[model samples]
Target: MKVLIITGGNIDDDFASSFLKKNHYDEIIAVDGGLAFADRSDLSITYLVGDFDTIDRTILEKYIHRPDICVHQFIPEKDYTDTDIAVKLALSLIKNHHSEENEEKVIHILGGTGSRLDHVLANLQMLKNILDEDVRGIIIDRNNIIEMIRGERVLKREEMTGTYVSLIPVTMELTGITLSGFKYPLENASSHFGESLMVSNELLEEEGRIFIKEGMAWMIISKD
Candidate 1:
């Protein structure tokens, strides 16, 4: 199942709405102020999760009364952030409805960046916790799409889109890294956090692949 989780960050309504219409998503979950964005986009938000801190009380009351939407409210002084709760809820829903054998559980997180740099960094690190899980997820913003990769994976580049692809070493001193069909290709390269080896690399062809022999890495594909 394809689940789209919209967070409370700055969102491009036009791009997000257009993307949703083009893709067939099984569910749409909005986090906090994201509900307002979803409403403006004319999208049906199935689940709303967050603390009511930033949301307008009047608007929330109207939506809460509606039977179609399932609203989950948290305390203002809660431990977890709204985005964290939304992701956990989505995982639970996916686990309940989808079979264990299904391999297409995709979680697309929108509005995950922009404001609150701490939250953004936390959300990025959250990917590490779920790296070993069955679900595949990515945090999407206007400029970049961030995802965590374990083992070996191929990343195919598209023309005029994702102009640059960068790989940041998270841990384990990423080894056996190889990049094909890119401006700067590597073969069994090892890098640390401060290394400038995997930044601002462009796609030479229509496709490329990134592989790690030992550890995991955070892949940041961006359009400038």
Candidate 2:
């Protein structure tokens, strides 16, 4: 199942609306202020989650009255952020709806990165949880698409998200890293925190491969 989560962060309406037009989502979720985006775009969402803080009262009431949508309301003082709760909920729904006939499960998060550095970092850290669940989670904005991975992954030039691919360690150290089909390739190299050695690499061939023997890392495909 492919799930889309819209959260309360900076979202370029043009990019986001265009994305929706080109993609098919099995489910769409609106989190707190994210409901505003859904309302503005006239998008259909299956689930609504968050505290009633950021959204307008009339809008919140309209969605709450919708019988087709499941509303999950939390207090503003809750320990976990609304996005965290939404992620857990998305995973649970995916598991329940999963079947032998279903394709790979994925969660795409929009409006996840913005002016709030703290929130952006926290959301990045949450990708690890999604990885642990064996569900692919992607944090995306207008300029960047981010994901966390361990082991190996392949990137196709045709399917490249942006102009550059950057690898940043999620752990203190990532060991035995290898890169192929890249502008700057590496073999059995180790990268540590606060290092920019693997940044801004480009694909040199039709397909690019990344292999990590130990530790997880963030793969950011970005544009200027």
Best by lDDT: 2
**What's the residue-level lDDT of 43 in candidate 2?**
91
Candidate 2 per-residue lDDT over residues 1-224, each given as its tens digit:
88999999999999999878877988899999999999999999999999979989888888987999999999899999999999999999888984566488899999999888999999999999999988899998999999999999999998886999999999999999999999999999999888898899999999999999999999999998
lDDT, candidates in the order shown:
0.81, 0.93
Worst 10-residue lDDT window for candidate 1 reads: 152-161
* Model 1 bad stretches (over 4 Å): 100-102
Which residue pairs show backbone clashes in model 2? none
Worst 10 residues of 2 by lDDT: 97-106
Best candidate, TM-score-wise? 2
Candidate 2 segments exceeding 4 Å error: none
